[model samples]
Target: MRIDRRQLLTTLSVTAAFGGLIPVIGQAAGSRDPRLIVIVLRGALDGLTAVPPIGDPDYASLRGDLAVDKAAALPLNDLFGLHPSLVNLARQYHAGQATILHACASPYRDRSHFDGQDVLESGYSVPGHTESGWLNRFLETLPAEQKVGSKGLGIGSTTPLIMRGPADVLGWAPSTLRAADPDLAPRLMDLYTKSDPALASLLDEAIKTGKIASGQTPITAMGGAGDPKTMVAMAEGTARLLTAADGPRVAALAFEGWDTHAREAQRLTQLLTGFDNALGAFETTLGPVWNQTAILVVTEFGRTAAVNGTQGTDHGTATMAFLTGGAVKGGRVIADWPGLKAAQLYQGRDLTPTTDLRAVAKGLMAELYDTSSSALARRVFPDSAGVAPMRGLIV
Candidate 1:
């Protein structure tokens, strides 16, 4: 399907209007204390591969060929082990700067990326109805003055659905090596507004800020040129912008290419290495502000608990959500302990979800923004009053 930028903006405008009703919560007035960054890992992430359970008695048996041995995996704790390629993240975990939420997922149980992302970002109980993201709703809830013009920023070629909300939003991608003619921006904006008012507004804002709407080669560029290494480069660039003095307080980014249908080991290793480098970049660039920043890395869902015929995993349930930053209460794996035994698996195929991903997100919002749990559940994530915000996720 073709991606329509204007249609997306119009939807966001409508959502923004309704989001204003959400009650303000979190962060006291005049507190520029914390920054929040969310990285969306599109396509299902194989949590079993990232954070292997080397100590689980049945893990090796269940995973069989996909199982990673303790000798090869990077040890995170006595019970959990990380992929060897994720050495940077493992170091952070040891330094008390990272934590993993294993067997966590959105309330949705389906396999569609669109629906899963909708539930994850919209904060609504159901999919498609949530026009705005929980983050935008949180921004709307803030007292009027604290709501800056651009409270949200999106990185990459096209903005992810999560950051598309009514709040003032800014988008930035690295400048293309070949610059466009100076007049091209204004001309494009004029054409867009005349043809589509909603798209016009978005393009106008982007143009006014001297940001390009397109042209930069995304890390996903093919031919191996836009592989994991390029992805890390993009992350570093995004981190630099987020940490800037006048930059946005919150941002969202998405990285694709995690769908490992075959040759899982080689592909997963390279991807994890890229992920590790990206985390290192954020830690380095954020510098002092890194202490106050919290980064939540999540995916739409998890892969199957058991390997498929192709030696790959299928769309399943209960993936891992990674939390890192100076503010995180780190060095621990948070889970309610759903064992990997055959009968313990959800639907007899995937790991059963013990923690709602939203709870972790709610906790981050509450801690970083000082928002109240009540508001987070009721307003940010509608009809989510029962899913209390997790505690001690951030220091």
Candidate 2:
């Protein structure tokens, strides 16, 4: 049942022959659906901080001094409240353009962030040896012709392992350089291939598209600045690229600095602000195509339900995943109802996860690419047959 490198590549080719690649071109005479964007928030965002529980009887006591005032929280519903810093997303939610999945996490139960991320991205129950991510696997399932053009894109200094696979892929990092140096691109490609075969193949594809050697100015030069702002600008750039006629179909964007172990208020606010801006950029840039796109914002897991002695939260269980875009069936918080009671908490420390994050991901993949849950479980997220893909996530 284990997939090796070569077999994995072959599987991609076969999958591409059937499943359609994303970032699909112009709306067909009868076709309307288009693209999907995935944003991964690293460092395990504290869902309780981002979206507080204003209705939970024990919420204030559990969060202690770190709890945000009801006045400061943007009311999503009478029960669930959003951090004031997420005004942008809050507006989207109120407008029926965003939805939240609460008390959710990857099947992995261990506390290691690295392993948790691996399980989250690799779409596997266990870590240490997943070869491809569920997104890439979804790409593989697309029709061969649909798979044509640039492969998946990774934004940031390093390509996430989630987006790495046999499929042609590309990497873009916002830099201060005015433009890509024609000579430097091929040299860099050579270096990558020599150092890492996987990255080499990816770079080769990027170069062939003339995207790498186009001498295009760095995205940062186009007004991108600062930590979270820079990240949002990166996402804006990604949305622009994905919407292009000749641009990539699938893309992966990662935002760091969500680990709020201390100074939860200030740090979480900044992180959520950055996320809000990034999402706003995507919505604004996508324009009319926005309705055709679906953006899934997810994290490795949630932090402890109760604030710790450090004035922040620690890695624990459960969390929230956001689905936004024109295509999302929004204006609702999706969950299996795991309460925040002390006895209800996982290990009596974290919010007990009631919904499997994989189901949400699978639901999106199924709707966007016409892939089935069976394939998702068998090839994309192995041993997840017990987890059915949730429906009604797409408009």
Model 2 per-residue lDDT at 395: 82
Residue-level lDDT tens digits of model 1 in 1-395? 12466545433321221111111122335655577888888877899999998888989988889999889998877778999998888888999999988989999898887788888877787798656888777777776565544457666555667787787566555443344555655686678778877676665544433321121322223222125765666566566556555556777888887877777888888888888888898888778988888899999889888888888888888989899989899999997769999899999889899999888998887766678877887778889888988989988
Worst 10 residues of 1 by lDDT: 15-24
TM-scores, in order shown? 0.83, 0.84
266-319 per-residue lDDT for model 2 (tens digits): 887777887898889888877787888888988998898877788988888889
TM-score for predicted model 1 compared with the true structure = 0.83
Clashing pairs in 1: 16-166, 25-371, 26-369, 26-370, 26-371, 26-372, 27-369, 27-370, 27-371
Worst 10 residues of 2 by lDDT: 12-21
